[model samples]
Target: MNGMLPWAISFALIAVALAMIFAAIRLLRGPAAEDRVLALDTLYVNGMILVLTLGIQFGSRFYFDIALLIALFGFVGSAAMAKFLLRGEVIEP
Candidate 1:
């Protein structure tokens, strides 16, 4: 019903999308494994942000759930990758 909120959301969505794109480029072109992992983590965070913003715009619980899942998996994945980079193993036997 208001014009300003829609514009604000649109701007946020575009900004998040651009962040995701930059993260993706970093993931692809990073010189170090840690840099790539950081980029990947950034991508996930940006993705989660985009999802939440979209949820706010659309008033959808589904988007929130998806964003939560992304956050969980992204954290787990970053931890695993960090472990692997440090010790060459995600799960030590």
Candidate 2:
């Protein structure tokens, strides 16, 4: 029973890693600005999930903090990019 959890986490980690790779490729190769932005968002989410699972697998609270930071930064970056795309700028005067 104890062995299955680790195996599951390992599999999930690998899956998330693969997702991140694909998202990176999309970000680099996407032809449109919106596509690139979407890819960037996906990449950040996959990374955050990966870190969270790693934290669980390793039983450490430090990774949790890292995951939280990732979430915060990723959301802000994505929002800024979207705003720039929509309004030609990220900040308003």
Candidate 2, pairs of clashing residues: none
TM-score, cand. 2:
0.95
TM-score of every candidate relative to the true structure: 0.95, 0.95
lDDT of 1 by residue, 1-93 (tens): 669999999999999999999999999999999999999999999999999999999998999889989999999999999999999988998
Q: After superposition, how far is residue 69 of candidate 2 from its true place, in Å?
A: 0.6
The C-alpha local distance difference test score for the whole of candidate 2 amounts to 0.95
Query: Each candidate: what lDDT?
Result: 0.95, 0.95
Per-residue C-alpha lDDT of model 2 across residues 1-93, encoded as one tens digit per residue: 569999999999999999999999999999999999999999998999999999999999999999899999999999999999999999999
The ten-residue window of minimal lDDT in model 1 covers 1-10
Candidate 2, residue 24: Cα displacement in angstroms equals 1.0
